[model samples]
Target: MSKSGITVNDLLKFSFISDPQVSPDGNWVVFVKRTIHKQKDYQSSLYVMNIQTRELIPFTQGDNRDTSPRWSPDGKTILFTSNRSGTNQIWKISFHGGEAQQVTFFKNGASQPVWSPDGRSILCTTSLKENQSIEETESDAKASKEQEKEPEPYITTRLKYKANGQGLLEEKFSQLVFIDLETGEKTQLTEGSYHHNNAAFSPDGKRVAFSANRSEDPDFTMISDIYELDLNSKILTKLTNSEGMYTAPNYSHDGKKLSILGHNMEYKGATLTRVWTLDLHSKELICLTGDWDTEVNDVAINDLATGAGSPGAVWTANDDGLYVLASERGNTHLYHIGLDQRITTVAGGKRQIYAFGLDQHRRQAVIGVSDPQIPCDLYHVSLDSRKETRLTEANQHWLLDKQVSLPDEINFTARDGLSLQGWLMKPVDFEEGKKYPLIVEIHGGPHMMYSNSFMHEFQVFAEKGYGVLFMNPRGSHGYGQEFVDAVRGDYGGKDYEDIMDAVDYVVEKFNWVDHERLGVTGGSYGGFMTNWIVGHTHRFKAAATQRSISNWFSFYGVSDIGYFFTEWELKTDKLDEPDKLWKHSPIRYVNEVETPLLIIHGEEDHRCPIEQGEQMYVALKHQHKPVKFVRFPESDHELSRSGKPKLRIDRLNEMAEWFEEYL
Candidate 1:
């Protein structure tokens, strides 16, 4: 390895691997590999690997993004979604290697392909016009092409009219459709004005289970229930009637039970997701991990690469158990849950398992893992022996000559007797008795945890001779439901204390930390906290907040999820207690700010809209406070994680320069 430190340019050299799916016979594994080209854009392609010999070969080639690969039931063919035909659609390719055949021809495109258990049909999701048939949609397209086009005005009717990345509402809903393999005929399985998500076929192939909000007031309520659609009768049965969000339903091997991940919303957005089993015969629901403290999904957020989506609760062959991923403390690990309600760790350590595919018969799995020093790679992990064999080294050459910083795990107690967990990364080239500037980094999703994964932003800060400290405060996942729920209705209360306590512990324990030259920065919820910290106390010399929320009063009506999110998180009825919403807003305390602050926001961000950053900037500017606002064009709430490659680098450089000038 070279003695030089890592730089922003080094990010393009790393490759990201995700969505590993093993063939039925356990002989081969197919996965998606993504790479950044000339720091312009990301290109993803599918690849296959031999289990025994560890030979890797590319299955799909080209610049088009190909992802979400799934093995056919017979193991003779592989199916995936690709945009090679100009738009994303399902395509099928033989396992022996050949040209992929297009399956769907929808104008809106298709995604999330799931094959039937008998391999006769494939189910996918595609957006369709509300209350309009496929023929009508095609007719409208033809007419629009023939006539001279004019700018159309947007007429708003729905409560939620715009999404962050999807732009303005189009009166379309995502519905399920199935394609017959033999006849190549397409049929719409479900239709509605509401959205359907996480659709899957039952083992018997007689019914389909999916989650949707079929209520009359779906725009006002955030409730979704699991439903089963009978193929022959065209009857939809509600399997769950809870008040919370329920989704990602998968049938057991025997088809007698269903496993799902959800919460009752008792704690609102901070509620921990648990695995529940439903008896199809008796209609009895039981939470399998009711007593478990960890959150039952992947919450390891990082900025290095795009993450492969999770396929919840992979069932075993005999239906006696299932494998699921859980986030605990600072790591996401695979766990096996038995029918008797016992939980056991299958493959786990101080590492993040981003994605995995299980072969129950062979007792082996193909998993995507990464750590502080490793970007990400695939490995063959044996469930019984707990032995992990490296299968791919996509980043070895780029990382070989780079000096990366590894985090030191930390544990400390909050003033309220709460145990908080975090990590500290020292400067890359450390010298004895040398004091370095400390930067306290906070994670978004007050519910998301800062886990043991590769973080490009943190490493960049460390390389610039700064000590980076990040932690899971009171509202973060991986902890129990109570701990995760503690931050709700108390936004800047205990959550703020937990972060400040973390900074205090680091400053007292580490002798090389310059307490006078401290910096604080975070995005989303963390951004709100950064604003809160500087407003409440001027402990840090400089602060940078990204995609933040300043005033909850205006946010309730303007944001996409504002109406419910403000009520649920702030624990106040916007109609009844408007003052409570303003009480927790950072803009309420802006006059107390004395530190040099930097505000970064995405112009198209709907989660925390640009108006939020604007409100704060205008207030600070009017008060003659030292603050500057930077706006990124065509970016959303995910700018730091999956925005354009060039913009992401510019964002990092901007933050570093702000701290370099102020701190």
Candidate 2:
């Protein structure tokens, strides 16, 4: 594995694995691993394993960040979420282990816990202020810490007032609380100014389900319904009336069904979340993956690991079926479905599972996955012989010595006759009439894809000799929902000829590539398609673009999803289309940019907002073209997936020194 190759210092020697769980009589599993330290930051912890003497252990240690775990329906405890007592709360411990016990002291702390099928209560989620409560935000943080008071002015009237990595706009709101494990008592449970989010609880623990938005202009409607409540008659109930976007929910273990995860914002935010269910005695509902056109979870993006939330579907202990995880085309798998709707798969291939758990008699589960040469771990599958096993090697001895690459899975045809999908790699030291230098990259959820994940910047651009590629062009998401709703109102049209027919079908089918030593990159909507491909094709020769947008008319008022993602991706109506958002602005094709670009961004990006890379570096340096920009500081739009590890290794050495100074 290591004949040298894969460096950004092998991404601080990789160690990822994420969330897994599986422990309610499936004999232990837990999970979350993370790593990266001496390059300063990112630690995470909590482990466990056992699943029949495959023993492992560690369950929470130093460097803070422990995460979501759960279990306890008499599996003898385990709850989780930690910030080691400095903030993010909820603790618990015990499945044959010792000391842990914190469990919520709330002054805006506490998080996702759940456990209540008669385990004497605990539901969680915190954030407060708007009609203030959690004991008046813990007595106004103990009277602003006994009086040094000066910093107070943030009063913005919400229409989504700020939020990228949660900055500014804090009239608070995250809600839901509960607690009581035999008299410790806490109880807030739903307040106002919106946001309730993924709560769960019902296999008869007297109700709790969640997901909120409660209309009356929740920032001009991105809907989000599904309610429930009733923890002894504080009654709430609204189980989705619909304009779309519900969320995680859960229930059905004989409580007669609920299961949620959502969509129906037709294609707003490129829709596809699917898997519905409801039926709690005919309050009806249905969508069980309405014709399953992929994406029921995991949108494969990977810079080593952060994913571990969606444990969505999971039902089958005779709830008549559902295991879920979907994605498709670029593989995410683990399927099942059935109460006669059928589906199937269970476990998958071509890798990238990203997270999973499931026990109390759903046989065996755990998962996490990854591929294109591993960087994610935790496995143990077996739900009736689907096999798997390898429970955690968190980056096996720094990926057994290195030289990685592995990609080649193409498929082309787009000069509008659609059918895309890409991936290429090839260049870590290959020979036989050599040529090389190609790059191409692009992927930032033009509905997210470039699948079979585990990308570390396409393996450090195939260890610098280049040849990368990467596609899924037509608004991605493993295709279908009319190809992820065909790039909403056609951003840079035909997703820029489906990524220039995937770089002209890999330079007319790869003859060791070269094609004038091209290059190109991407970030948010692949940095607005690498600033709409160096302002509409000067055919590559270097370009970068990260966290970009370049003016959907000043990104429809400075982006945090810029006022409804500029009226749902420029279908206009931002007050009757400012000339159709300056005709899909890449700053109106910056005087047709010629190439050597680079831009990058992030100064705390409010989702593609470093003023959309300072309006494409001031419209390509006021048209004298050849750009440069950079930015970063405290970063955002997840500066290349979870920033700061030496600014993600100095943003991959500033995109490998701007493509080694112009391709």
Score each candidate by Cα lDDT.
Answer: 0.88, 0.81
- Model 2 deviation from the true structure expressed as Cα RMSD, one decimal place: 22.7
Give the clashing pairs for model 1: none
Candidate 1: segments with Cα more than 4 A from true spot: 135-148, 360-362
lDDT of 2 by residue, 212-259 (tens): 988887888878998887788888979778689878878878877888
RMSD of 1: 1.8
Model 1 over residues 505-525: C-alpha lDDT tens digits?
999999999999999999999
Displacement of residue 302 (Cα, Å) in model 2 is: 5.5
Q: Alpha carbon lDDT of residue 309, candidate 2?
A: 78
Error of 1 at 141 (Å): 5.7
Whose TM-score is greatest here? 1
